[model samples]
Target: MSSFTYHSLPGFGEQCCEEYGFSDACIIGDRIIVTGQTGMNPITLQTSADIGEQVAQAFENINNLIVHALGKEGHPAHHEGKSGWEHVVKLHAYFVGLSSIRDQARALMVRSIKQWCPNHQPLFTMVGIESLPFPEHHVELEVFVQARMVRFVTNESAS
Candidate 1:
């Protein structure tokens, strides 16, 4: 029944979500879900045309969101493993031109995953799409996080 409010990125506000009716990130207990992220820069609010860089930036954006959700509020801190990137347990990747760029995309994703989780690999599903919501965005990543959920129960409740 307990849930954390959505943590939206910059440039996305009430109007944007009201139109789309979606939030960038939401957390329920320990589980977190982040909307597909593009290579948009949080500061500049721009997406790179380069696919490789776009993939990297998209992952970076996911990392930023994880840190915001897992770490202490108002303070920058690394998550349990690999600076908050490990919290990302699963990913759904969308590519604009899959047939032409599958190899490049796979390579970059593998390299990035290694850097994030050296000991384990998160399950990934890559999909080819004609286009993305944002025209300039070449790659979009949907992130899912599952952490240990703990609830405090008083003696009365336990009894």
Candidate 2:
């Protein structure tokens, strides 16, 4: 049987999974899949009016999910409380206004990657869309990660 780890962060992560019946992030062997993350605040459940702010929040949310999925003490990928961005191999971003906010979004996205994954570079894709699921959300992000697992997980323990 294949090994897998499913995780949902605190706050909105739990609520979303419970209501939608999907996990926020899941690990299959050494590959990690993270769901699309918006700029909405987890606690407030609100997206900001500013596009820059929304872009930042989206990256933050993505990082939070990755960290929870890989940074826990017992997780095979855990690494000294570091940001899980290190394990990311690819990033996909969706923007509400690709043409209008292209420059701003590009700058912000570059800045975020530089800050979060200083030691490695990750593939990235950005595209514009007419709108997002939430009216106020200007950006959404999803990530894929490849990390080596040092330990084995039993089916019973995974549960």
Best candidate according to lDDT? 2
Tell me the tens digit of each residue's lDDT in model 2 across 68-144.
78765266667656677877889999988799878988998999889888987889999999998778888889999
User: Best-fitting candidate, measured by TM-score?
Assistant: 2
**Model 1 local distance difference test score:** 0.75
For residue 11, model 1's alpha carbon misses the true position, in angstroms, by 3.9
lDDT tens string, model 1, 17-58?
Answer: 777887777877767888888887866777777888898888
Q: Name model 1 segments beyond 4 Å from true.
A: 12-15, 18-21, 72-82, 149-159
Which 10-residue window in model 1 sums to the lowest lDDT? 72-81
How well does model 2 score by local distance difference test?
A: 0.83
Total backbone collisions for each predicted model: 0, 0
* Candidate 2: pairs in clash: none
